[model samples]
Target: MPTSNWNIMVKASQNPPFAAENYSIAEIKNEVLLQIRSGKDFPVTSAAISLIGQLTSEQEVPVAELANVVLGDYGLTSKLLKLINSVYYLRFGEVTTVSRAIVLLGTDHLRDVALSFTLFERLQTDASDHIINLLCRAVYAAVVGRRIASQTGYTNPEEAFICSLFHTLGEMLTAYYAPGTYAALSKGITGSGAEESARVRTSLLYLSLGKEIAQSWRFPARIVCCMEKPTVKMSEHDDVYRLSCIASGANEVAHIVEESLDPEDRQRKLEKTLKNVHLSASLISGNGDLTAPVEDVHKYCSLYGITFERSAIARSLNQRREENEQAQGPLKRPTNNTAEDAPFDLPPNFNGSSSSPFSSLPEAQDDSETVFTNGLREVGDAFLEECPLDDLLTIILETMYRGLKPFGLRRTLLLIRDARRPAMEVRLSLGDPLASIKSWFSIPITAIGSDVFNIALSEQKHLFVNDSTVPPIDGQPLIPSWLVEHIDRPVAMGVLPLHIKRVSIGMIYLEGEKNFFTTVPQNYLNYVKILHQQAAIAIRQR
Candidate 1:
């Protein structure tokens, strides 16, 4: 949201409000970049990556020298052999050793193969579907971009392959490092947003993150330029321009194919996007002057799990265009086309015409209740879902953020109720970085008011203060001094206590845009209540 107006809100999206966790979005990037520069973030320049880089270069790399690097890691050697041997379609003889595979695949083809396999081996984590999709897109784009590069007669298609492969580096890194922020931001990502493609959401976010890492690693000037893809115009046959165009085109096509559920919608969008890269629908569909490299696209799809035919693609694109022609309607081209390498921009602000605090409220599709219930079920598992203590709290906090409609609340905090101290300690704050990891929001368990959030925790009841300035129960200003010390202004808040067999354990506190807390229908509030009650039941008696 923050292009200034939502800076705090957008910044809070990642810089989790935890103890001493206050950081601007820029600061968060600097911190992450520092770690990356120190070789602490992602394994970008591992031995395998370095060796693959050498293999990808123009100079002839000695087979014995390349094999020595591969031989250092038993796992890498085995994988190299298996991958080479598995490419039965290539009709290559079985490659039983890394040395032979290197010689057989040759310098150029070998580089492409090694880069893909090395990256797969390095960045592979216990990834979720979103993360896996991110990884897959990088690899998919690499293959597709390489195909495009070869057709366009780029000097080094291999270079284009790698550049396109890491185009989403920022997005993938965020998903891996800060799944919390990744999950939080993921809801509104529908690919084509009001200003840019849905993928632009993270792209806008991670461009800086990716650039810093790429630069720090001292990658080639052209590759780093490709990563930033700064606003510029280039002549035809400009190597940099061709690389950027092919990579961008590949990614756009991959997104249209993979993310969109509606085939007709997918086709309609793909044509408009390809235009930005100076590619026509006819070229891609093989109906143009240049023969379409349909085989390359199909091979990439089959190698990955895309599992769709070439005819299906042509049918979607051509049929949609035919329908538009018959109606005399011009197909709408999205104004913010990242595929063209347009000046990267943010979506309009939260209160601006395009978005809102509730922009991403979970839709039920056809069944309303399942939306909340299914989410709660997942949260229930998380509450008891054993994890490393550090990660356990993060999962709990993130689950709570989603369990409550993410877009519905401005700020929510997880508080650990301490009976002996008669107070609550703010453990986590969602969407409010100032409250995060700080005791600034703590309130005594026995706050001297009927509507105070802590009273809800102490009494094991759901407490809703419709207006903090005026009491809902008896027309008194129930907002306590402890709360006033923390809140800069009057605000409404709710607290639902966690209990085990009706025994109070802790509480969940949520605050929204002033009176917005009161506007939530009781039925929706009950969903949050049920979430707490179910999570409490799952907590083992300890």
Candidate 2:
């Protein structure tokens, strides 16, 4: 470990070099960088990048498509939904599904989100605590930089973010992949003096290499420049310079927050950093707590259903006693990529039904047409060991409800016809999952043709009526008298009689925001019929 002999003194960043056992530190660093630069497969990055690239292409990508891609990587998908619901991106409320997120972010923003996440996901593999901490700091800087840029009237805050986030890519790659070199080079990192500063200055070789990687990826020049020349003057007229200032200023703030002992010092640095970006110095003057950015990161992680390195951080802050109990020995670092924690493998509402209609559909095809389908089949094998027939039936109805969701059907009622009487009773209703059914409990089975529910029941057929399409008879409505009397007003409705083995069980009534059915495609109505038939079979068998 003598300073005079650099070769013998070289120690690894965290562990042994992850290269050919005999390779030197220089060869290891160069080899790893070369692999990332041109190799067809990257140990961690390619799969993430490829998947993200597919999901974020120019064409209109369906929510189903996003969900489908995420099925194989359920934890990743959960993180996406969680991130979408994070405070930064959250617009409305809890987004239980990917399709809902598409509606909110639109395709372009979704693409950006996918890109950001894939980068994060890829870096998570076999990363050391130092690197993970650095990545989180980068993320915090990115978020803070974006906000700072926006407050300063810079147009592309997202560009500012990616540039800033990737600024530490070299350091990250070296720490995990070229540990020997990182270890040796980081040996002199001891002081707040010029000697230490000189050592860090020498470390710029990796940062310079990071810029090359970013450039190779076809990133905008300004973005590449922001990472390369983040020390550019904040007062410059050009967007690149301004962006660099914001990104650099935010990174400095992140570091100050990470290192400062006094809360007031951190607050002062944060205010100064904000002012450097032309943002109001008073913005974050109230809080100097270093954990604020970490909290936001944890909040975002929670949105992704991710509980790992950061989760441990959050829990440790609140569980010093628990941490002490574990302090009896060296602690094993819990990995973030556990397969057991997949958030959407079986959503709470799906009730673990293997017979879900989403199973029968063709495996998601890349042909734009079916690319947007959900991944029920992805986790189709996972279902309740004892899923009762009733749960399956409910799953069918819920499928229909979500299927017709694009058509805006707000209510669907399944009225079963009792053998003892000519009355159709609303045995199951969908809308408010918790609402009482007693109010819509029953309807008489009239013999009239105009009686939508009765005609479907008697004829054992499906009746889909678009009120707008039903021409008026002598200027009077063609709908049944029951609808006119019992309902608030006439609206578009579809009635499908459920039958099994030639015996009538019930009829389904689908109501929508007036004329909702008119816009619904014929294929959708056909699917509804299939669901009705499926439900009937399930009921009869059960």
- Give the alpha carbon lDDT tens digit for every residue of 56-101 in model 2: 5537443444433443354555565555655565454544444445
lDDT of 1 by residue, 161-186 (tens): 77887777777666666665666556
Which residues of candidate 2, in runs, are more than 4 Å off? 1-29, 32-44, 54-72, 153-163, 192-203, 215-225, 234-239, 263-294, 303-542
lDDT comparing candidate 1 with the true structure: 0.54
lDDT of 1 at 354: 27
Count clashing residue pairs per candidate.
8, 6
Minimum summed lDDT over a 10-residue window in model 1 is located at 343-352
Who wins the TM-score comparison?
Answer: 2
Q: How many backbone overlaps does candidate 2 show?
A: 6
